[model samples]
Target: MCNYGGGLGKSLKPFVEYNEPGKIMIIETPQSKSAQLSACWGPIESARAKVRGAEGVIVSGNVRQVDQFQDAGLPVLSRGIAALGPREYMRLGSVNETLAIGGLKVDPDDILLADDDGVVVVRQQELSQVIESCEYGVKHDEVVLQAIAEGSTMKEAWRKAYDLLGPPVEYARPFRR
Candidate 1:
């Protein structure tokens, strides 16, 4: 589930108890720089979250305890790292609610996909379609790469793949929001 904060005090029990295991923990702070007073969470809390079965955490603000988190194998994606703690600056703000982070509106249960490339959010209803498209793209790219390896020009390989796979049915439509 999602949690919102403005950096006040420390009480994450509600979030831990409410969040489902294997789901992402998204912590949204204010957009302004001044509001991010300290690190949102540290090693202790990361451990707590791991024990509770959280898949990972995405913080709009800063985070700390990088080594400890890495050792614990807990994935944490944040704005940056910090040494300051959150205990003195954060309090429960909102839980399981919608948040506008980085100009993107994120709602609870939205599919959050994060990898080395970055993060992408897919609405729950669009998950299946997105997956299908991704699978198709992967297969198509595989063909293109194979063709290129066999000495075809990049443009020729792309043309051959397109000719074989045909254009996507949704190519004419705008992307789903």
Candidate 2:
């Protein structure tokens, strides 16, 4: 992940070099005392990163070239888009350090699972437990699916799942308050 201001430095070579299979690039530019613009990269930069083997990019700020990025099949998540480029305003920020992203402290090598549903990060230390929970969830849902397939109503199948698997797990912050 990278923390930068509105301007993207002259080169994004470092980020491209760091890109590897199974790795996702996450960028953040929080609201600052300035105009608070977060301009990291546009579609062209996104394509470059993808070509270098980045699985996807998650931007906490704005990006440009939306249509091109989407057509290229490079997964990109951003708050919005802008016409401005980073030629004048870009600067190199911190990389591979703990960063505050969407109220979460993200670390290097953490597992990021993002989809239409949303994005979730599993710290490296809790990976095993998270995987086990995911496995259990898949199996539990399978039973509900089977019941629905067997002519049970959606509500009925869900009730059966609750009875069999117990209540859904409650949310808990990864770190202590």
Candidate 3:
């Protein structure tokens, strides 16, 4: 789930109101390309966010105390890590607004799915379609795996799966090899 917000910089001011359970906090720094900016998040904030029920965090800028973040049980994806905290170097920005992260435009309420692989954003309107496609892909993979387990070669497995499941989804076909 995704509930978009910024204001991750160091500040005495509290942002508790913006916290929403089961939501991922997406933060973007103003001058993200510059090395001067301090880490937007750290261990303490990670713990706090988790207490507030945040599923995870993603920062367009740097972060700190990565190990502590893991200890806090909050999954955080950041550009990099910084020794310095955001105090003095940066301040909280706006919340619940559109953000540009790595050339992708993230809007409020957009669904964010992340794992060791990476994060993928799905527009709110496209959620149902994306879920359907993913379900189809899982079924297709099951068929392929079953075929391969039954002594079929890789190519044969794919062919058998395709014959049983039809062609791969449009978006996934080009990568099917």
For the record, the alpha-carbon RMSD of candidate 3 to the native fold, in angstroms, is: 4.7
Question: Stretches of candidate 2 above 4 Å error?
Answer: 6-14, 33-38, 87-90, 145-155, 163-177
Question: Per-prediction TM-score, please?
Answer: 0.84, 0.77, 0.80
Q: Write the per-residue lDDT of candidate 3 for residues 1-177, one digit (tens) a residue.
A: 121223455352355347789889887665534543568678887878889898898877788878777766789988778888775535665677777776777787788898767778888777787787887799988988998899999999999878988876654321111
Candidate 1 per-residue C-alpha lDDT over 7-102 given as tens digits, one digit per residue, 9 for 90 to 100: 434465566666678988988765455547578767877888898899888888788878877768778888877787765336667788887777
Ranking of all predicted structures according to TM-score, beginning with the best and ending with the worst: 1, 3, 2
Quality of model 3 by C-alpha lDDT: 0.72
lDDT of 2 at 126: 78
Q: How far is candidate 1 from the true structure (C-alpha RMSD, Å)?
A: 3.0
Per-residue lDDT, model 1, residue 87, is: 50
C-alpha lDDT of residue 53 in model 2: 80
Candidate 3 regions exceeding 4 Å error are 1-13, 31-33, 87-89, 171-177
Candidate 1 C-alpha error for residue 110, in Å: 1.3
lDDT of 2: 0.72
Model 1 has an lDDT value of 0.74
